[model samples]
Target: MTGFRVLFRAACSRVEGTGHLRRCLTLARELVARGASVGVVTEDNPLARSLAFSSANLSVHFVAPGCLFADLIDDVAVVVIDMPKTDEQLSLHPDWIGQLRQADRAGVSVVSLGHVSASADCFRAVIDLYPSRTVHAVNYLEGPEYLILRPEFAASDIADGAFSDQCEANRVLVSMGGSDPQDLTGTAIKALIDTGVTMSVDLVIGSGYCGDLQAWQTQATAAGLELTVHRDLGANDMARLMRQSTLALVAFGTTAYELMALGRVAAAFTHYSWQEASAQRFESLGAIRYLGCAESVLSCRRIAEQVRQLLADRDAMAAMAKKGQALVDGRGACRVADLLQTYAQETRDRQLDLLYVVAHPGDELMGAGATLIRQIDEGLRVGLVVLGEGSASRWNEPGPSQDRELAQRGLKTALQQVADQLGLSAWYYYRFEDNRFDGHDRLDLVKVVESVIRRHCPHTVYTHHPADLNIDHRLCFEAVITATRPQPECPVTTVYSIETPSSTDWGSVLGHGVFQPNWFESVAATLERKLALLELYQSELRDDPHPRSLAAVADQARYWGRRIGVPCAEAFVLQRHLAATISEQKHSERQGES
Candidate 1:
């Protein structure tokens, strides 16, 4: 999980618009903040290049136009598609289907932002930011809550307290998205003129706007409407203008969501069927007033009347603003980042070779720490799971709650350091009561162990011996046994029981079965490193005469080494190992019958 990577593939141009690439940049910043290395792949266009240059930390790769999704899946864990559902983009590469199959076969996860035409099933996840009422797929993440708006729109210092009915609202903000491919900005201006209301109009246009601005200015002057045109404003300046406006007249896109996040009531117009679907959903939430589709000639009149009604009735505007602000919290990027990180970690954990389950803090170090280090050095991926709090046993009565919390925090920090030093692929620490394993039901421990076993899917597992004097150690052994019970789906094929020094030594005196070792691993090179790591748990070590002491641990290593004819070794009793020859034996039987 050290180099978790994500690559975003999006399209941008005069026709496709720049919203897809811009939103990907916003989400990329959030992923980088969470320690993910992010890159963006988009068409080599002027607008995309300018926007990409603004985000300095992100690695941007420019591809030829209409070939944005071709040959871009490199050493990344996940590929996010933010392209439109246009017919031209979909038909650009005939081998798009085969490319997706190859990525799947190579263990790469593909996620989509918005619907891809005729290929929804090819994606691992479809994040529809503007979804309709019916659920599309089980993996489809929907609604305005997942809208990826810039963080500036959700700042704390901008106060949108209440709309005042006493003061007549005059300012109106108009933006027709990055590219008004259908010239909806002209329709919005005509609608504003038809409203016959005296208000200051602030028109915002993006880099892709190709309309006749001079003609629009002439018409506004003739209509006696006060108009100020702002071109290509950045996020901070746009947010500043949004804060000053009482209402927004916008096309259906990222601007609509930004208006909702800022509580600026907006009446939306749509050019595409998908945009209309999103508008209807937002209108149903009382966030925006959806004027019917802009494709119809009469929709202009509809927008005109709605603008008149909204300007006249301040109470309705207040209600709409409150609902819109409450609907979007502007943290969708963070949620999406969390989803990608989880998938990346799971992808990494599936390659694990060994997992060690223990009962307490220093138990792993005392038992098979040297062996764990040796296997990891030989390029075997290893993980660790601690099942108890490792501290509450020090208290006589139920200890002060705050003191226990502090001790638990310290132990977690120490485990993090140990995992880093040992280069473990994954590690988890759970807090079952320290020495109270007997008080809990046996099934509960089995379920927890089973859950971890299913996630990591290690080929070999190591746990405490069943004959240990400690109650937690005995229960831990039982849990691992039941969790790894032989089934066709279980990845575990071998299980070994390692001896903890003090607990295993005292078990024989109390009439419990002694640990008889049948497997010994040479740890001549890693024994010193294991002893160094034990210093992290100094509170758990004792004097020279005790079996848990540092000198006594080295002496025990020598004793096990002498028995196995090695300089140093760790001994284990191999309880179970399901040999991997069943498939071979079945093949031989079928050949003989033939």
Candidate 2:
């Protein structure tokens, strides 16, 4: 309940295969490590049960084959579907689509895996782990960068001197995934025997496999080979076998990716046409030798010949091993987990109506904290960005006593607590020197602001007025203006300038510019929360009568609200506003051109 609840719906069966389940398990393991509660929904097969039993944190939901999942979509943060069987099946599955639609309507995010040919509009995002040339929809995350691999496979080190020509080659690994409906394992074993090589064979058979295990053992013994058959091998055991073996003959799927991660030279074949693309991609990358479909007799002979040649030619095997290792660094699961985390964060951020760009850590709370809390109460996402370190006052004190670094660290911690109290969807800080904006290059400041704006892509932006007494406040206003300028692709449709308690009021006496308010947001319900959050910045708070004093801040909110006939409110100067339609049209035109 503390973390995200992710439900994985995979296409798995004894007759179909377990590749989808295996990949889902890899991602599930990563998610669990990141404090997620994972549930897997698949057919009640031996492999599915085995996977569920292996992970203490995983909950298994057994669905009958060709039947819809039961009512379990509520309360899930994310629903990840890994149905690599077929696009038609994914699209036409009534229960699958209904669950996804229900989750989508309930504000839960949905992600699809290996959805190459399906319509991507049903889900929030689609992930294609293999190298693909097809142009997908905007929500698709394609290419090898998104490949998901188990932690053991990802953490295993590449074999030392594995590519050396003088390295001894003795053992070969033959694994064709959890349920080889076409009996590719039997074919691979026979092909290895036909090679007539004097090497030990490590055959890994899945629990769900319905092949004749006794016949395979007899054939291996008659061919004068030392065969070791492993059943239901776990991830750690598989990694150990892959490391110990000199070469692998695997069906093109998750197993091939595992072998590649371990830097094992492999000749990959496909049992299904859907796997050809992945096999050819690995072959082109020199990571594996593609032996075509395993069902073809000629392809089986080719697999045998390739095994013979690779064993005899140490340099070729080493080159292949090195290439395979180089292609898959084993950190792909981490990358994918990061994306999922970001997507979850962005799901919340998408509801934000405003992003406050401030010059110091406590500026937002001191300026428009009540307004932010009010917006959140009204179900709007609110974000914060503090551009300066806010420690210049401590650093510039007359006494050389305080540790400036320590003071800054404490200020940052206080800012984080304040942000949390305000329920900010996203918060960022740039530790630039406080009150020293004049000393830094303006272009650098602009670029920094631009990056944050691009990331949050908020519909509305709030910053300081340009005519502020504080140099950092004035510069931050200028940078925000430049960063959120009306561009064809920019998401900012409206920008407002708010008054910081110390900076905005002090500038009135200088006659530089008056702090005039054109907008007032009632914060009567949240003024107490705002004041409470402001108290966290003890280093920045002042005694009564000072402009930044707690009492004065409360009085100012009442004063602004009284002018607008409200109990309490925050004031803002409307700087720029654009129609949402105009921005959307420009964005669409730009996308079309691209």
lDDT of 2 by residue, 423-498 (tens): 7776666556667777777976787666556555688999998878998898899998998888897889899999
Please give the distance, in angstroms, between residue 396's alpha carbon in candidate 2 and its true position after superposition: 59
Predictions: Cα RMSD each: 13.8, 15.2
Worst 10 residues of 1 by lDDT: 132-141
**True lDDT of residue 41, candidate 2:** 85
> lDDT tens digits, residues 1-594, model 1?
359788898888777788899999998888888888888999898888888878888988999864645555778788887877622455677666567656655666677787643543345556677654333211344555578888888635356534444335579999988888878888889888999888889999887788998888899879989999998899999987877787888888888878777767788888676667778767876778987675666466778999999988888998988777776767677667766775577565455789999998889889799999988888998988887867777877875543543465567557757877898876666657778988888976787677557656798999999889999999999999999999988889999999899998788765768999999988889999999998888768899989999999998998999998989889999999987698877995798599
TM-score for each model: 0.60, 0.60
- The segments of candidate 2 whose C-alpha lies over 4 angstroms from its true place after superposition are 155-161, 164-167, 295-298, 352-594
Q: What is the C-alpha lDDT of each candidate?
A: 0.78, 0.75
Over the full model, what C-alpha lDDT does candidate 1 score relative to the true structure? 0.78
TM for candidate 1 is 0.60
